[model samples]
Target: MNQLDIDKMVLRLNVGYNGFKFKESDLKDGELKDWAKKNNLLKSDDKQKD
Candidate 1:
């Protein structure tokens, strides 16, 4: 497996996170909805549509 390191500060301004941590398996398993929910990017009504 390969890993990438990102600066949390840079990401915060762009993706709205002061700090973030993730494993490659998250992507591999297609878990972005979980991520969005954690970041408050997904609304409950939006989830119901899916």
Candidate 2:
């Protein structure tokens, strides 16, 4: 079996966070909505910054 790095995957999903830094916790979400909230993606109307 192969296990993907969910953290890297989640970080890459964020258009603002693409190629940007992210906290390991971002990958801990069981749902995208929850993850988005934790990473401030829901409230972030603009591109994110490092």
Candidate 3:
């Protein structure tokens, strides 16, 4: 997906789980990427054995 799609998806999913009160300043691009990795929503490092 493009950046816009990713942004929308992140915002919707974040707020849905968090609540409308989550300050946008609390997010970073890396956090989104991290979430995708940790939960397997995207992918994890191939060399990661943890």
Candidate 4:
């Protein structure tokens, strides 16, 4: 999937899951990318293992 598709999927799935209320227009590209990365919704480049 492309970035747009990934963004939409993540937003839809995460909303209301952990008290997060995200709308389509609520976040910008960078913000969404950061949020996704932080939440592990997207591939993380972190070298540290869990």
Q: Better model by TM-score, 1 or 4?
A: 4
Candidate 4, clashing residue pairs? none
Question: In candidate 1, what are the lDDT values of residues 1-50, reduced to their tens digit?
Answer: 22222332333344455334333233332344455546543335332442
lDDT for every model?
0.39, 0.49, 0.52, 0.57
lDDT score, candidate 4, position 9: 74
Q: Roughly what TM-score does model 2 have, to 2 decimal places?
A: 0.29
How would you encode candidate 2's per-residue C-alpha lDDT over 2-22 as one tens digit per residue? 234564355547647564543
Candidate 2 segments exceeding 4 Å error: 1-30, 44-50
Provide C-alpha RMSD values for all models, in order. 8.2, 7.9, 11.1, 9.8
Candidate 4 residues lying further than 4 Å off, grouped into runs, are 23-26, 29-50
TM-score of each: 0.30, 0.29, 0.38, 0.38
Global fold similarity of model 3 (TM-score): 0.38
lDDT of 3 by residue, 2-39 (tens): 88568657766755675443332344557665554454
Q: Specify the poorest-scoring 10-residue window by lDDT in model 1.
A: 1-10
- Show model 3 residue runs off by greater than 4 Å: 21-50
Error of 4 at 32 (Å): 8.9
Query: What ranking emerges by lDDT with the best candidate at the front?
Result: 4, 3, 2, 1
Prediction-by-prediction clash tally: 0, 0, 0, 0
For model 4, residues 1-50, the per-residue Cα lDDT tens digits are 78877876767576536545444244666866666656655432454453
